[model samples]
Each structure stands twice: as structure tokens, then as C-alpha cells.
Target: MPTVPSANPAEHLARTVDIVALLERGRAMSTPVLRAAVDRLAPPMNTVSSYHFGWIDAQGRPAEGDGGKAVRPALALLSAEAAGAAPEVGVPGAVAVELVHNFSLLHDDLMDGDEQRRHRDTVWKVHGPAQAILVGDALFALANELLLELGTVEAGRATRRLTTATRKLIDGQAQDISYEHRERVTVEECLEMEGNKTGALLACAASIGAVLGGADDRTADALERYGYHLGLAFQAVDDILGIWGDPESTGKQTWSDLRQRKKSLPVVAALAAGGPASHRLGELLAADVKSNDFESFSEEEFAARAALIEAAGGRDWTSEEARRQHAVAVETLDAVDMPEQVRAQLTALADFVVVRNR
Candidate 1:
């Protein structure tokens, strides 16, 4: 058995270095492909798409922004490397995954009524809802088009994988919307919803590179499992950040999730805890539901609810769960006999998922 590096204090610095380098490479490779693909769109659509990606401003001029972490694309490239293929072999898959991701983001922002993303106005807020929806549709179509341009066999498989993931993502979003209207939600249901909403795409991304690289089914399956668990961890951490993260770092209002009355993991966990704090939170949430006003929470009220969640052990439980999922993701890599370097990088990425501030 290849010895996996322990996620110990001594390994922290090295792991961070590996994660940063892998992410940088992913960004470098995926960005150009994404730009070229978006450039193929017609005038206003192209401008809207570019603005959504932080590539250009509303005036169709260049802008300065980090875009995003490019985590899914990085996973695709890394999976290809783990399958013993050159990173370039996965560029098409990486680009396809990223387009699908952004497509979902554009639609999600509209559905969720989000005003800001990455500390800037969302596409819908800036470009109008109709145009944003059209652009999202265009991006989704483009993802399929790009994947089909690959050789026949690979294109067919990747298209099937991506389509299935997209379906699950949509189903998850529907469920999430429904959950908000209900008075109660179980943790199990929330996990399942998150798996479909977030995990499906990440799983597809992790395996697409392997599929393109001609890796065996076993290797592809293992990487898919790795991504699924990583997705869960990522969502769990995101829930924590939703209520507690710095507005500047997270690129959203502080306690934004609570203000929206989102039934995220931490909130669900606290509701299930059944303590005094939980009871108080339930009352607050109930009042909000009765008022039908999600945007009414004052900063002080949001802070109080956050404190209640922490007092009820929601924060700790969610944090520990994120770490647990991260561990599972790392362990799944053991099933694939990749090069030590590739495994190390994958492990680092897993660590980064749980630890990222945004």
C-alpha cells in the first residue's frame, strides 16, 4: 500500500503549497478555454457571460478579479494526472465542467435572489433576469457542444455523465426550495439533497478526466467517490461560512444564509439538537416564516441567532462533519494506484476544501 501523508500539523505547510500550485495550474489551463468558448456566443450574450465570469465589466471592457478558485476544474485535471495522463489531456473535460458549474451559478443566483457574488453584482442583478437566464442556457449548451467536439467515444461518455449530473443538480435545487417552506427538515434529507445538488457535479468532474484519459472503471469510480465526499465537505464548510464568515472574504453579507432562512447544514443541525438554543432559534425562524419576510433580520438579531446555533453545538458538529467528509475523500484516493505526487496533490486539495475561508 502506498503510504498517504497524514493530515498532521507537520504536513500543513507542504500541503498548502501543493494545493496552491495545483489550483494555479488549473486556473491557468481552464481560463483560456472558458474565454474562447464564451467568445463564441453572440454580442450581448458574450458580454453578459464574460461579465458573470469576471472576465469583463458591464461595458465589455477588461476587469480585474480572481474569477473563482476553479476547484472543480482543478479536480478534473488532477484526476487525469492521477490516471497517468498528461494534464493537457483533461483540458476539454475541465472546460466542460467549469461551464456547467457557471451555468448553474448563473441560474442559482437568480433563483436565490442573490445580489452579490465574489463581492460583485450577480449577472442577473447587472444584466436583468431574462438575459441572465438566456446566458445560462447558452453556457449549458456550450458545455455540451464543447464536450462533443472531443473524439466520439470520449465525448459520448462525458456527455452522458454531465447530463446526469445536471439533472441531479436541478432536482437538488428544487428540493432545497421546497425545504424552505417546510417547518422541519431532517439532517439525512439535507445530506442527500446536498449530494445531488453539489456532489453530482463534483463527482462527474473527478471522473471525466479519468474517462478521457482512458483510465479503468475502478480508478474512475474511486475518483468519483472522492469528489462526492469532497463536495459534502465543501458544502458543510460553506454552511459554516454562511453564518460566520467575513463578508469581504466570503463575498456576501455576513449571516446571509440566516437572513435568507436557508436550511443549510448548520441550521439543520441546530434545529435537530433540541436544546434551549434550538428552541429559541425555532421561534425566531417560525416568526420569520409567519411574517414571510426573510430580509427583516437585523444585524443584532442575526448575531443572536448565530450565537444560539453555536450554543446548541451546531457549529462544532458541522465543523467536525466537514473534517470527517474530508477524511473520507482522502481515503477514497487509496483505491487508485496513482503516482505519489498526484496522490499528494489530491490529498492537499481535499484538505483545502474543508479549510478554505470562502
Candidate 2:
């Protein structure tokens, strides 16, 4: 049986050839369509939208760095290429996926009470919850509107695909919130929730390009599976980073997920291990929760908890799981016949998903 790839930091870094550059290229191609759609919103709504996208400051001045890595748009365009279509043919789909992604981020930040994102105050923190909610709704609506502009039949298909994915995404978020209140959660349950919350949108982004590019259902479905597995790998890596990443590099507070008591994959896996380390972790977590002292942990205590989690094998398990999911993602690509260059790019993107540090 094939084992998970060894974690050679150098090898991983070697494979990590600036996937962000491809994402940026896709962003450049799709930004005009996205801007036109957002501009259709009312005055303050447009302003809030612009701020959230990192195009402008809270004071409505044009500032750089409003958006994300544009990963979804890149996947859309790449999927389109894999289906034997020009990347431009996927522009509308790319824009639609990106809009929906930002909409989720806006709402998620509010729901999670996250004050900061990408090293800036979130929309809710800067603009208030009501405006944040409104802008999120507007973005979702605009995504649909943009898709419909693709012509009736294609628009209808894309809309159905996106809406179904959106529903699953919402359900996943709901499950995630609910998990926080529960005393015990299994790894299987955690995976399901992450798959729904993170995987659904990525699946849509990947398949939408194929649909728009006139690929048959089989090719689109294969790409969707590829994205689904890739999403799982992405989230698993993100879970690892949440606990161990550099605050300066990840642009978040140190141990941010643990600070929030989030039941991320590694945390749940640690809890489920049911040994001395697991018991110790549970005690620490419970103490924090019972005393309402989540913020009071010293660096030493945090380090101890992280060590306990590693001893419980949570870190190693999650890392291997990420590699396993990445392997599956690459395998799924074989189901479709695409240009070698496109296939290589997609494979590289899959490797980057598991190996990325931030």
C-alpha cells in the first residue's frame, strides 16, 4: 500500500512554486467583472463592499490589499482549461465563485466574532454587523446575477450548482458552530462538517468552470471530486497551521483556534485519542472553559497543551491525512483527459495545498 509522503520541508518547498501567481492572474482577469457587479450596489453598500475586498480603506479612500489569494477563481479557470476551453471562457464562473467566497467570509467573520482577517479589521469590526450582513447578501445576489449574464441555459446550470454548494456550505458552518457547544466530537463528524463547509464551495468552483466551458457532466463531476479532496487537504493543513503557524506569517493571533476553543481536526483527533495526553488536554481545555479564562493562558501553558496534543499523535495524524487527501485529489484528475500542461498545473496546485505553510 502507498504510504503518505514524507514531510521533507525542502522537497515540499521546492514543489511550492508560487501558486499565488496563478491565482493573481485569474484575479486580474476576473476583477473587472467583479467590480462591475459590486458597483451596481447602492452607495454605502458599494463602499462597504469595496472595503471588504481590500480595494479601499474604512474611510473610503482607495487603498491596496482588499482581497484574498483568489484561489477559487484560479481553480475555476484551471478547470475550464482542463475541459479544453479558453481560460477566458471561465471568467464569469471565476467571478461568481469569488463573489460567493467573499460573501461567506464576511458572514463567517461576523458569526465567529473574528475582529481581524488578512491583518485588517473585518468588515463587521470596521463597518458594523448590519452593514456587513447587507453587503454579504448583496455579494451573494450579485454572484447569481453575474452567472445569469452567461446566457440562459448556462446560467441556469451554474446557478443550480452554486446554490446547492452554498446550501451545503451554510449547513457546514451551522454544524461547526454547534460543535463548539458539544462536549465530545468524533473525527468522522469533524471531517463531514469540514467537507461541507470548505469542500462544497471548492467543488462548485472547480466544476462550474467545466460546466461553463461546455464539458459533459462526467468531466465536470471528476473535477468536482478533485476539488472536494483538495478542499479537505486544504482544511486539514489549515487546522494544523491554526495551532502551529507563525502569527506574523499567518496574519492571526498566536494559537488563534485554540484561543477560541475551536474543535478543529487536530483538536478533535487529540480528544478522541483517549490516553494520558488526551486526558491532560481535556483537563486544560475544561479548566479554561469552566473559569472563563480562555485568554489568560501563559505561553508556557500554551506550549504544554501543544506538546500534549503532539504526544497524542493529533499533529502527525492530521499531517498524514492531509497528504492522503492530496494524493486522492491528484488521482481524481486522471479521470478527465486534459492537456499535459493543465494537468501538471492542477497537480502542482494539489501539492501546494498540502505543503503550504500559510
Candidate 3:
């Protein structure tokens, strides 16, 4: 299949600027002042989070400009806007999500032995694991600090949703690390892992949206489910792309997932085949990539594997599930609890996530 154009991060940045403008006009939470404070709150651990978010220079000095895409922040804001609170009510919490997401990336790069992130040397590559771990730890602490300022949030309700998502994010990462050693995983377990690794934060984004939306319990639950399936779709698509995407277009190696033996969705689907593909993969497990050719599979062979993922229904299945969750997400917004236009916009963003190239 031909690769469609990837979404432009610069254009997405412009849209986010628009969204942030809308949130600022409502001016519910003093975000400018608070963002300033968070920037100043901690300066230790080499400030990798700050740099990752483009809040500071590589030298730990303050700078101006774009942070990593802030997709989670957008989801949090959109969720709130869809919920009708103007997203300003949830901006601080949204910022926490962005920070936390980057925090995970910093550590993930280290654990995965990735060298580059967003086209630059990864935190660990620049600073070593000990310092990278400290940086991630500091960001985690900072995320809680930011969350606390959310102000009188109901522990009985909104706060619980927020904290639960954060806790689950850690749990999910732990599961991903554990998968490095496991020889086989059932599809059901894979779904659970995706839920933890990918779904949890997205659920939190929508849950935060609902809380700020002033939505009731039932609608909030629906939104959470929407986020869950949306995340699953995101991960499955990522899994497929990991094996076949254009390294230049996607900014990742096509064979990296297979090389690292990640057991992504496509590989997972192929493993279910119980034939040559499965047999080959099983042999690769607990084995090292010794030769330069790595078993003589051509680039075209990898491309076929990508098509196999789509043909075997791994991609289609996840996409259909995303659409289903999207409908549920729309239903939550349509509940007369929120404005129609805001809900529609957020719904569109959900669709965009599934199809976005990167």
C-alpha cells in the first residue's frame, strides 16, 4: 500500500496554538502563571523533561518554542472542551499529562537502548542511564506537583480518575519491559498490555475532559471506554508501522521492532499463523542477530509482512475498534451535557489519531 502523507507537526502545533488560545480566553485556570512556576519548580537532573518539552535549552537554560507534539495535552484539552468546561479548567492537568508522557519517553529510550528521540540524541544517550533515570524521576515528581495545583479536585471523583491513570501508566511500562523475556503472549494478554501501556493515559485524557466538561458519571465512563479503545487502536497501528514504515517518513527504522524482537501486533498476528513466519520468529527469540544480513529477508519481505498485518485483520480489527470507541466518545459528548461543536471537533481528532502516519 502507498503511504499517505504524515501529519505535519508544525501544522499540528498551529492547531494546538489555536486550542490554547480558546482555552486562555475562558481563562479558568491561570495557566500562564502556573506554567511559569512549573518551569521554575525543579532545575535538577539536567532538566531533560524541560528540554524534551522545549521549555529550556539543551544547556538547561530557558528557551522558547514547540515541545514534543503534546498529543496528550490536546486530548486532555479537547476532552475538557467536549465536556464544556472550556479546557481551561483542565489545562494544568493537561500539562501534567504532557510532562508525564515525555517522562515515559525519556525512560523508554533508555530501556529500549534507543539512540535518537525526535531526531536528537535520546536522554540516556546524552547523559547515561543513572542520570536519565533521575531525570525521569524528577519529572514524575513534577507531574504530581502540577496535579496538586489542580485545586480542590474531588478525590472522590476526578482526582481518582487522574491518579488511577498515572499509576496504570507505570504498570503498563512494567508489563512492556517484562514482555522482552516472554516467549509467547495470548492475544487477550496483548490487549491488556496495550490497555496498560497505551490505553491508560488516553483514558485519563478523556476522563479529565469529562471531569472538566462537568459531565456526570455515566458519560464519563463512556468517555473512558472511548479512550481505552482509541489507545488500543493507536498501539496496534504503531505496531504495524514499526515493522514497515519508511524510516525517513516515520523517523524510525522499518526493521527496528523486529530487530529488537518487540513482538508487536503484526509479529503477534504472524506468530498466530503457526507456519513459516511463526517458526522463524520463534527461532529468533532468545537468539542474537549475528550476521549482517539477519537471515536474508529483503526490505520487500518486510513490506509484505506489513500487508500481512492489514490482510490478517490486525490493522483492520484495531481500526474498527477505534471507530467503535469513537462512536462511544461521541455519544458521551452528545449527551446534552456538552456543546455539539466541541464534541464534534474532539471526535474528529480521535479519527485523526488512528490514521495519522506518525
Candidate 4:
């Protein structure tokens, strides 16, 4: 992983402290509010949401498990600070975004038929698809309720932003599902889908806090741009991980995306880069398409496809694109004037986004 940038010893220590501290800080600040929001659900939904959040086990016993990285909440809080407001001012934004994020996860696991996440049974797997759909709907409602109840102009603005992003996210998911059945998905098409699916919500997260903190549109827009590019970088890295990441860390089986025949960035780029290896990779993929025999694919078959992707420079291209997007994300920050400390923290978070393993 890349080291956090440091200008001087004292600044470095401050940046490091801020960087490490914000994740825990965000979790601490957002969890109670999020739990309270989840508690609004009736009966089994409450139980299911609680279990999904890792606050309890499947048997209703209190047990701590991995929740998530809390990246959105941290960004919300940091964005508040960037707007020259107290971090506490961003708590509602933090909780709302976190709620929206988990809502997506619940639905995504069910839609994608993913049985595992964070090394545990997915809500859909453990609780069933009915509960997953119900609880996801409940969470989405709760996210809007939390924001709209604030009853301020800024709150109204933030709600509109969140809803807009949610619509785009849904659109992206639709595009993703549609792309799966098609034989050819262009690199441009893939980026657009990812930009909507991943980038839209991240842009909202990056600016919603500032909106709630009463920031002007210019500053909020700049931060939104920062987050949009950061989201692209994040998804690119994620595509790479989907193919080559360690299953133990990723909480998925080996060759996970390949098993699903996901046309992620690497796969699209590899097919776009024509060569002997690329042609062979295309043949293999075309054969799989015709057979529709992903389940019967042997370990060696998946491994050979992975190797072909690498030899065709798919992996390297995606990696370079990640760095390029990261640069753009960081550069967008220049348009906003905020505390120096907050700037460093946002940059650190952007670094974390591009370099993160999961």
C-alpha cells in the first residue's frame, strides 16, 4: 500500500492521527443514530436489520462482527469540517448515508445472489429474500425520514441530493444486470454504469454533509467532483480485486467475478486491447457465453482466463486507470477552500479509497 503523504514531522503526525481516527470516530458517531433508525422497523425486520449490522448474531444473541469500513460516514464528517462547521453538525448526514449504504448492501446481496459478506452469511442467505427486500425498503425509508425530519432548508437540500443519487444508483444496477446478458460491453459503457452505480452515491456522501452544514453550492459541487472521481478509482480497484483478490480477505470464493461472468473494467479493457492473448481470451469467453456453463468451469479454466487477462494487459490498464482517477479526485479538492487539516484528511481518505483491499 502507498504511504500517507507527509510534508513535515508535526503535520505528518497530525495527518496520520486524523486519518486513523476518523473511521472509529465515524462509527462511534453514526452507530447509535443508525441503530435507532433501524429500531423503527417492526419485529423481524428490526431483528434482521440488527443482525445484518453485526450488532447481534443470527440467534438473537448480542455479538460483535465486522460492520464495514465506515467510509461514507467518515467522508460525511470530514466534508462537514471542510465546510467550516463542527463535525457534530454532520452526524445526521453520516447516519443517513450509512443507512442508505447498508440498504444497498442488503438489496445487492439478494440481487447478486451473494451468500457471504464480511466473512458471514448475507442477510438474504440467513434471513431469506423476503426479509432482505423488506428490510432494505425499510432502511431506505428510514434514511429519508432521518433527513427530512431535520426540517431545515439544508436538510431539504440534502434529502433531494440523496434521493437523486439513489435513483442513479438504481439505474446503474439496472445497467449492470442488462450488461450481463450481452455478448459485448464496451469499456465506455462499463465506466458509465460504474459511474452511476458507485460514483453517484459517493458524490452525495462527499457533499451531503457540507450541504447540511450550510455550505455554498460551489464548495459542495467541488467536493462532489472529488468524490465522483474517488468513486471511479474505488470501483476500478474493486474490479481488480473481484478477479484477483484473496478470498479470505474478500469474503468470496476464488475467481468470484469471473464465476459470475461480470464484465468489470479489467475484462472490458482486456478485450478492447487486441493481441494474441486477448483473442484467445475472447474465444474462451465466447465459448462460455455459448455454453452458459460457468458452474462447470474448472479451477484451471478460471486460472487460465485470469492469466490471459493479465497477459493482455487488462490488470495493468485498470491499475493505471485507478491511479489516474485518484489524481483527478485529489486535484478536485483545489477548488474548495477549507481547513488545511480537513484537506489533508480528505486526501488521506482518497488514498485509502484507491489502495484499499476490501
RMSD vs true structure, all candidates: 3.1, 3.4, 5.9, 2.2
Order the candidates by TM-score, highest first: 4, 1, 2, 3
Candidate 1: count the clashes: 0
Per-candidate TM-scores read: 0.95, 0.93, 0.78, 0.95
Q: Which lDDT values do the candidates have, in the order given? A: 0.86, 0.84, 0.62, 0.88
Model 4 residue runs over 4 Å out of place are 1-18
How do these models rank on lDDT, best leading? 4, 1, 2, 3
lDDT of 2 by residue, 1-358 (tens): 1133544323343355567788788889999988888999998999999898889988889989737667788889998999899999889999998888888999999998888888889999999999999999999999998898767676688889999989999999999988876657799999999999999999998888888888888998999999999899989999988898898767777877777778888888999898999998988777766676656678888778888888998988899889888878788887899887777777777776777778
Candidate 4's displacement at residue 201, Å, is: 0.9
Candidate 4: Cα lDDT at 73: 92
lDDT of 1 by residue, 57-170 (tens): 867789986589889889999888989999988888899999989899999899988899998899999989999899999999999999898867867877888899999999
At residue 267, give the lDDT of candidate 3: 57
lDDT of 2 at 42: 100
Off by over 4 Å in 2: 1-20, 287-296
lDDT of 2 at 237: 91
lDDT of 4 at 35: 89
Instruction: Report the number of the highest-lDDT candidate.
Output: 4
Candidate 4 structure quality by residue, lDDT tens digits, 180-206: 777778999999999999998889999
Candidate 2 lDDT at 46 equals: 97
